[model samples]
Target: MIFDKLKKFDIVFDSPEMDCPPVFSSGDVVSGKVVLELSAESKVESLKLHAEGFAKVHWTESRSAGSSTAYTQNYSDEVEYLNRREVLLQADNGELTVLSAGRHEYPFSFQLPEETLVTSFEGKHGSIRYWVKVKLHRPWATVKKIKKEFTVIEPIDINTPSLLAPQAGTKEKMARTWYRSCGQVSITAKIDRKGYTPGEVIPVFAEFDNSTSRSVVPKAYITQTQTFIARGTMKQKRAVVATLCGDIVGGNRRETWHGRAIKIPPVGPSILQCRIIKVEYMLRVCVDVPGTSKLSLEFPLVMGTIPLHPFGSRTSSVSSQYSVNIEWLRMAIPEQPEPPPDYSSVVSEEEAVQNSTEVQPEEDLSGVLQRSLMAYVQEFRLRPPPVYSEVDPNPQPFAMRPRCMTC
Candidate 1:
């Protein structure tokens, strides 16, 4: 209990108005307070607080040479965007000799750099993190410290004309066995545009022609590719964010898909601003054929903060049919007829009379019986009556017993 009481320290942000997973961009001021509660007067040296935002990448590899010579190589990279240190209290300043046995609060603030910074990301090889740390210095004991981490997001806007332009790609591949043509699979996939925001749906149009002898399944997905470069060595990672698998296509048949959309998720935008990390998005469609190699095509995509305007708002001179083929396909897909009326809605007069007879009027016991039941319940109430008892207004104090005999 004594040690638990002596180790009390807390750091809290002053921006209560910010939502959970507090968000901030460049050029924002972050302020917070550090609180220390001492069970006894113990602190002697100084108190320091640090605020820092940085990205660090560390990876190691082992390389072996011929005949018993081996070496380990380590790669480390760090970028510090914000670093601020504040001395809250110091013994050399002669402000106070010893910390009192009470609570103390120190306020600190720092302005983030106006330059763009990478968003906070935690990957296997690297991480971009921002944190606030507080340290309590003592004479003979180890330093006591506390730290808190927060998130930093850099906004990427997609409102530019270049990002809003439509992106499309088509690829064709042939399969053969022993110099004889087995079949050819041709796939053409297109998106309304490259730019997209989180929660925004990406409309995909695909036409697959499978002239092969084997059955093929068409699959489409959005992938986030991250490229990390360190010391002239480049590493790449890819994650599929969304996918759509179409119906199987038989041999010598064409399958057209329209109105297929993949919604974007809350992922980091393209890492064009970061020097060592590069993030890119792609819309990939692959044809998986049984007993044969798969044919795939990828179209680059852009994820941004703003969603594209409606197709009608686009002022480009491109023909409407070329820009949005789904609108045309909507007219081609057969529409279902209106649903028939429900049985309850189409009740005949005789059926109505029968239903009325089944629903007899319910009895209303809302009069004297309800009153009597309520009265009976009130009489058996669990609460004591609020009657006043005569007692002395002035009372003498009594001696309290000790919690333990030793006390």
Candidate 2:
């Protein structure tokens, strides 16, 4: 009689309670063994093993403010965390055939590349840990994983600062890791005069600045409208309006417009006649870097004022000044006209001239000459009547009569 008895085994990690290295410093070799209990007299096909681990770091940047009132004080803080490091172990497996097994054991080992590891264990430590694990696999048997944790002790460093006192200007540069790039841009508007006079041009100018360490290209634009003001339903006032819009590329740049100066129309002091600065709209500016994962940042993209100037204020005065965060602005594609159709049919010289004549009306030089001649003939035919002269028919022989009287 032949008996086809199946082989059974139990897999266990050597150190189930012990933790792996807290931080896999560069060139650290992680080791573990698989403990197997073969059932009484059985045959096994094969055994497999796998080991994996990784190192990672994450942090955030934020803004904070504090205010003190007569009764109480308050402080506010905002935090933005972004992952900085990631190194994953490649999956590796080893297989072995078992001819006849009563009991067997397998060991596994692996190494983490030193160059890829970020050794930030000393300066900013509070409980940042990277984990590693060893896994054992057997043919037709359950797989077992062994997880270990360890403390990452920093090598003594005189320059290292305590966790509570992080040194200034400290930064980490890691490739393939996510980074939060920040930049500050300002939007300013200025009028030629403190106030604007009705019916006069008010010069306007704007400037943008990138204050953050990260370089950024910003969008900028400008707009202006008329606004009106009235006092107690009595007198009305008019003011010139202006605004800046569009993306401002290269943080340090200025857009100047001599046309911001607008002439106020002459009108009586009435609410209906009063004109006020109106709608001022602009697109939000933002840093557009391709390939890099875009981290979301909360910042103002637009800032400006309407009726920028108060009514009944001095003439030739500034209307309003506004600044917005680039993030808040929306992106838009400028409207573009479609291109003309390509010429598929070739035309001969004669056809080209014919088409040109057909496209343009022929001048009627002969008709113009005829009209002019007709006008001239009409003038001559309708000339004013010649003045009639009364002739002195009795211009008699006054000399003969005078001579006779003298005799």
Candidate 3:
């Protein structure tokens, strides 16, 4: 058979059940086998298997001065974890004398660390990655190698009291032109607390006062800020993760927003511990006029691993209304299931599918090796926009006087 006359190199994971895009957590054991098949006898020096995890960030900036433009590149790489070279076959040890060749399987295993590893994240300018590699060494020919990547996620818990306390921010701005004063605008925004887990709703409260001659529009949004540091210089990228907008406010009128909710996503648990990268969240409220500068307020937020208590038990009726559009909110939150247990703990009747050559019928095996790589490439190319809820048409107007006496 043609298959019996060809050489093959493959890496197969030892899992009870075959999983597409296999997942692993911290403190887990990753075991697999490397298979080598050859129909003809060949010279061999050594065979080695390697596994590693790393994070890398890169970006470029361009600045124009007159008719000339300058471009600067920034990058950083961190090897979060690594396991190197477990020799499977060595000619120096005289284990193999290179007689007949058919199929050979070598088992390999690695125990991941229990701490300081974050979930795998792939962004436009940065990525956290893990991979396994196999190398075949020959005396006179170039070395051949195969590599495969996997996913790792670290659980985040948000049950801390500090993150649950109520948080608020206020900002007031006076608009003034060259010769005339355009009056003033004030904004105050608050959230139920600072700490939030993925898939949980966040209630927001805001009061806007438009004392200026021109009408002002009110907007609120959640922002995620990612910072990358390289060569002692820092670069930051910001994305609006969720937003809600209120109706326009007439001059001399005040508008109050209540029961507005924004849902957090599974993409975060914060990236503060990472040395080269950092992730932060914020809530911002802004009031915009036709030509004058806008007034804005900002409140810091924390993404955690635990969900808040029930609204009825821990919050008032206003908070209860936060779930007014529960169905819509559900669509925004991504599903985050718990990581599968170690392969040893699970019971299965069938043999490991990854070890079976029948699983891959295609002539080229590169597709199986590059599955994770392709997924990341697609993710970076087709990043999805943030989800948003419709603005409430009838926001209640506050009757109290403007908090800023000058306005």
Once fitted onto the true fold, the runs of candidate 3 whose alpha carbons sit more than 4 angstroms away are: 1-7, 14-17, 40-44, 59-80, 95-103, 138-140, 177-179, 265-269, 289-292, 305-407
- In the range 1-407, model 1's lDDT, one tens digit per residue, is 22344656898887545433345669988887888887877645778989898777777778899989999988777778889899887867664447778887888888888999777665555667789998877766677889997656676656677776666667788877677778788887666566765445565566789898877888776665555567766555444555666789888987766536555544455666776666677777788654445566777887654344444323221221211122111111112133222222222335334433322122221211122111000001012212222222432221132222111
Which tens-of-lDDT digit does each residue in 1-407 have in candidate 2?
Answer: 00233233333333324441122334665555444444444433334443333222222323345464233322222111111221122233433434343445555555555443322211110112334444444455554445544322222111112211211111112112145444434333333222222222323222334444444342222111112112211111111112122343443333222223222221111111112111111111123222232211111111111222333322223333322211111111112232111111112234334433221122222221112111000000111222212222433332222221101
TM-score of each: 0.69, 0.22, 0.68
Name the candidate, 1 or 2, with the larger lDDT value: 1
lDDT of 3: 0.59
What is the lDDT of every predicted structure here?
A: 0.59, 0.26, 0.59
RMSD of 2: 39.6
lDDT of 2: 0.26
Number of colliding residue pairs in model 2: 42
What C-alpha RMSD separates each model from the true structure? 29.0, 39.6, 15.0
- What order do candidates take by TM-score, descending? 1, 3, 2
Which is the better candidate, 1 or 2, if ranked by TM-score? Answer: 1
Number of the top candidate by TM-score? Answer: 1
Displacement of the residue 122 alpha carbon in candidate 1, Å: 0.5
